[model samples]
Target: MKILLLTPQFPYPPHQGTTLRNFNLIKGLARRHRLRLFSLLAPGDAPAGTPVTDLVEHLVTAEQPRRSMARRLRDLVSTPLPDMALRLWDPRNFDTLLEHCRAHPPDVLQIEAIEMAPYLFGLLAAGVRPPRIVYDAHNAETLLQRRAFLADVRRPRRWVGAVYSAIQTLKLRRYERRLLRSVDAAAAVSEADAAELRSMAPDLPLAIVPNGVDLSAYDPRHPYPNPYGRSGPNLVFTGKMDFRPNVDAALWFADRVLPLLHASNLGPHFWIVGKSPHPRLRRLRNRPDITITGAVPDIQPYLAHADLFVAPLLAGGGTRLKILEAMAMQKPVVSTRLGADGFPVQDGVQLALADTPARFAARCLELLQHPERAAELARRGHAFVTAHYGWEKIIPGLETLYSSNDTLTGASDRR
Candidate 1:
C-alpha cells in the first residue's frame, strides 16, 4: 500500500509515547508498503536523520504555528472559529500536501492527530478524489483540555481556556463526523476512546488500534544507571515537559506528592526528563531534590537505573508509553488512576495505583522499602507488556485496517 502519513511531530528519537508508537508503525509499515510522509513539527525543529528521506519515498516538513498570546488573540479575532484560526496559519503545509497529491497521490492518507484534520477539510471541500482519511487519534486532545478546565485554573483565564476547549472540541467533532461519513475508517489508541467516538458518531467506522512500544530498543539487557541518581532513591517522570499535561503532572507531583515523602529524608529525588522543559517546570529546579534534564540522547539507561518509575500525571488522554516502557524494562511503577487510565493492568500486580498525594507517596515509599515486592511488580509489568503491548503483535491490526478498504485510494497510486 502507498500511505501518506501526516503527524505533528517526527516519530524518531521516540522518547515520548506518541512518537514511539507512530515511529515504530511508520518504520514497520515502511518495510512493507510504499510510504510518502507529510509530517509537521514545532518551529525551528527538525527530526535528526536521513532515515526518513532515505527509507520513505519522500518527506514533507512544515512548522506549526507558534502559540502566543498575540497569535491567540489574532486568531480569535480574525476567524469566526478560534480553533481553525489557531491552525490556519499552516496554509503552506496544505499547499505542500496538495502539490504532493497532484504529482504522486497516495493509496491511503493516515493523519496522526486532530490538529492536522483541518488541512484535509479544505482538500475534501475542493472535491479531491476521496482518499482513505484515517484519523490516527493519538489522544482525545480536547478532553485533556476539558479536564484541565475542570481542575482549579485561575478565575478570569479559566473561562477563556474553557471556551477555547469547547471551540476546539466542536471543530474536531464536526470534522470527525464528516470524516466518519466520507472516509474509509478511523482508529484510537484504546477501546475506551473508540467507544466514546462511536457513541458520538455511531455510524462512524472505528477500531481500537493501540499504541505499541518497540521492545528491541527499549531493552533491559542494556540498562544505564540513573543519570539524575544522587545518594538517595530516584523517582523519574519522563515525558515532553513543555506539554501542558506533563507540566501539570510534574508540578502536582513536586508540590503534593514529593513533599509528603520529604519527611522521611530517605533522599527522595525526582528527575523530570524529556525535551523542551517549560518555564513552569524550570521553576521546579529551585527545589534541591528536583532536577530537570531538558532532553537526553536515550531514556533506557535512566529507566534501568531508577529505583522506581513514577507517573503522578492527573491530566491527559490516551495510554502512557513512558509507563509501558518503564514496565518493559522491568522497573517498578507507581501511577495515578489518570496515569494508568487506559491500560489493562491491575493494582499491586503489574503496577501500583495511587491517586492522592499521601497514597502516592506511601506507595512509592513502600516500593523503595520492600525490594522483593518491588522486584515482583517489575517482573509482572514486564510480562504484561511483553504478552499484550509489544509492537510486533499490535501493529498487524493497523495493517489490517489499511488493507480492509482497498477501494480507499491514497495520495499515491502504488497500492
Candidate 2:
C-alpha cells in the first residue's frame, strides 16, 4: 500500500524521543509499504545523515515558524486553531503537505503526532481524500499541558505558564477530538492516552502503536565501560533537559531523593544527560558529584556505564521512551508509576517503581548494592520488551491498520 507519514520534525539522527520513534517506524514500514515521509524541519537544524527521501518514495521538508512577539500576538487573537498559531501559520508547510498529497495521493495518511494534525485535518477539509486516516497519538497533548499547568502551582512570580498551557490544552483537545471523529483510525503509545482519546469521542477508531527503539543500535554490551564511569558509582537520568517534566523529575531526584540515598551510605555520582540543560539543572552542576553532559553525540554509553537508570518523572503524557530503552539495554531502572507507563512489566521482576522520594532513592540504592537482584531485574525487563514492545512485534499491527480496508475493526484481531 502507498502510505504518507506526516511528522513535526526530521526523524533522522534520532537524538530526541519523538525523532527516534518516527525514524524507527519509518525504517520498519519502508520494508513493506511504499512510504512517503513529509516532515516539517526547523531551519538550519539539518539532520546529520541523508534525508528519508532515499529509503521512501518521497521526502518533503517544510520550514517551521519562529516564536516572535508578532507571531504570539497574532496567534492569541486571529488563529483558527492553537497548533495553527504555533505551526500552521507557516504557509509553506501547508503548501508542502498539500502539494505532496496532490502529487501522490496515498492510500493512507498517518499523522505522526498531535502537532501535525492541524495540517492533515486542514488538507482533508480542502478535499485531500486518503481513504485511511491514522492519527498516531504520540501523547495526549491536552493531558500533558494540564500536567504542566498543575506542576506550576508553587511559582510565586506568577508566570503565564499555566494560562498559556491551559489555552493550548483546551485548543488541542478540541482539535484532537475533531480529528478522532474524522480519522479512520487512531493510535497512541499508551492505553491511558487511548482511553483519553476515546473519552473525547466514544467511537474514535483507536489502537495502541507504542514508541519503539532499534535493538541492534542500542545493545548494552556495545557501550559498556564508558568514559564517564571512572568516577564514583553513576546514577543516570536521561531525557530532554528543557522539558518541564524531565526538569521536575531531575530536581525531585536531586533535592528529595539524593539526600536520602546519601544518608544511607550510597555515595553515588549523578549524570543527567540530554540537550539544552535548563537553568535549574545548571544549579546542580556546582556539586562535584553531579555532572550535566549537555547533549552528547550518543547516549548508549551513558546508559551502559551507569550503575542504575533513574526516571522519577511525576508529570507527563505518553510512555517514557527512555525507560523502555533502558529496559531494552538490560539496565535496572528505578522509576515512578508515571515513568513506566504502557509497558506492562512486573514492578519487582522487571523494574522498581517508587513514587515517593524515600522509596525511589531506596529502590536505587537496593539496585546499586544488590548486583544479583539488579541483574535479574534488568534481564527480566529486557526479556519483556523483546517479546512485547519490539519494533518487529508492534510494526506488523500498525501495518495491518494501514493495509486493512475494514474501518470498524482495523486489524485489531491480529494482536
Candidate 3:
C-alpha cells in the first residue's frame, strides 16, 4: 500500500511523545508499504539526513504556522473550533496536500494527530476525492481537555487556564466528532483513549494502536554514560519540559513528593531531564538537590543511569511513551495511577503505583531501599513492555486497519 502520512512535526529524533509515536509508526509501516510523509517543522527542527528520511519514499515539510496569542484569544471568542484546529492552520500545507492528491493520490492518508486534522478538513471542504483517510487520535482531545480543566479548576491561580480548557473541551467534542465521522478509519493509542473517542462517534470504526518503543535503542545493557555527576540514588522524570502536563508533573513531584522523601531522610536527588525547561521549572535550579538539564542529545543515558524513574503526571491523556522508555531501560518506576493510566500492569507487578504525594514518596523510598524488589519490578516491567509495547507488536493492528475492506467501504459510505 502507498500511504501518505501527515504529522505536526518531523518525527526523526522522537524525543517527545508525539514525535516518538509518529516516528515509530512510520518506521513500522514503511516495512511493508510505500510512505510519503508531509510534516510541519517546528523552529530549529531539521529533517535532512535523519533516519526518518530513509523510512519514507518521499518527505515534504512546511514551517509550522505561528499563531499569536492575540489571534488565539480572538478565536476563543469568535470561533467554535478548538485551539488545536487552528494551531497548525496554514494555506501552504493545505495546498501541498491538494496538489499531491491531484497528481499522485495515495492509498491512505494517515493523519497523525488532532493538530494535523485541518488538512483532512481542508481536503474534504475542497470537495476533492480524498483517499481512505485514517485519523490517528494521539489523545482523545476532548477527554484530554476535560482532564486539564478538572486539574486546573481547583487552583485559583490557574482558573484562567481552567476556563480555557473548559471551553476547549466542548469545542473539541464537536470538532472530533466531525473528524471521526469523516475518516475512513480511526486509531487510538490505547483502549482508554479509544473509549473516549467512541463516546463522541459511537459508530466510528476505531482501532487500538498503542505507542511503542524501539527496544534495541533502549537496551538496558547499553553502556550509557552516567549524566548525573555526584548523584545519590538519582530519580529522573523525562519529557518535553515545556509541555503543560510535564511542567505540572515535575512541579507537583518536586513540591509535594520530594519533601516527603527528604523528611524521611531518603535524600534522593531529582533530575528533570528533557528539552525546554519551563520558566517555573527553571526557578528550581537554585535548589541544590534538583538538577534541571535543559536538553540532552539522548534520553537513554539519563534513564540508564537513574536509580528510579518517577512519573507524577496529574493531568495528561494517552499512554506515556516516557514510562515505556523507562521500562525498556529496565529501571524501576514509581508513578501515579493517572501516570500509568492505560497500561495493563498491576500496581506491584510491573511497577509501583501511588496517587497521593506521601504514598508516592513512600513507594519511591521502598523501591530505593529494596534493591532486590526494585530489580524484580524492573525486570517485570522490561518483560511486559518487551512482550507487548514494541513497535513490531503494535504496528500490525494499524496495517490491518488499512487493509480491511469493511473499514474502507463503511467509511466511504458515510461520506
Model 3 lDDT on a 0 to 1 scale = 0.88
Query: Quick one: best lDDT, which candidate?
Result: 3
- lDDT by residue (1-415, candidate 2, tens digit) is 8989988888877887888889888888888889898887765557445656666878777777667767776786576477432653466678878887998999999988877777876797799879888888788777777777776655644357767777777887877778788788878777778778888988665667777777887787783557584665789999889988999899888888988888867688888999999897878999877789998888888888778999999779998889878988899999998888766766798899999888898788888889999999999988876766678777876765664553433222434
RMSD of every prediction: 4.5, 2.6, 3.6
As a whole number from 0 to 100, the lDDT of residue 15 in candidate 2 is 80
Clashes of each: 9, 0, 0
Give the top-scoring candidate (TM-score). Answer: 3
Model 1, 1-415: lDDT tens digits are 8888877767665677766877888888877899988777755456666456666888887777667778677666465553532463477778887888778888888877766666777678756654566777777654655565665344364576566665666655655555556566777776666666676667656666677777887789884665763665888989988887788789989999999888987878999889899997767888889889888889887788888899988777878899889999999999998889878778999999998899999999999999899999999999988887777766666765675543322111111
Tell me the TM-score of each prediction against the true structure.
Answer: 0.90, 0.92, 0.96
By TM-score: ranked, best first:
3, 2, 1
Per-residue accuracy of model 3 over 1-415 as CA lDDT, tens digit each: 9899999999978888999999989888889999999999999999998999899988888899998889999999999999999999899878987887777788888999999888988888888645578888999888888999999999998899899999999999999998888887888877778889888878777777778899989999989888888757899999999989999999999999998998767678999999999897877898888999988899999999999999999998988999999999999999999899888879999999999998999899999999999999999999998988878888877876775463422111211
Show pairs that collide, candidate 3.
Answer: none
Clashing pairs in 1: 105-411, 105-412, 106-410, 106-411, 106-412, 107-409, 107-410, 108-410, 224-301
Pairing residues by index, what is the TM-score of model 1?
A: 0.90
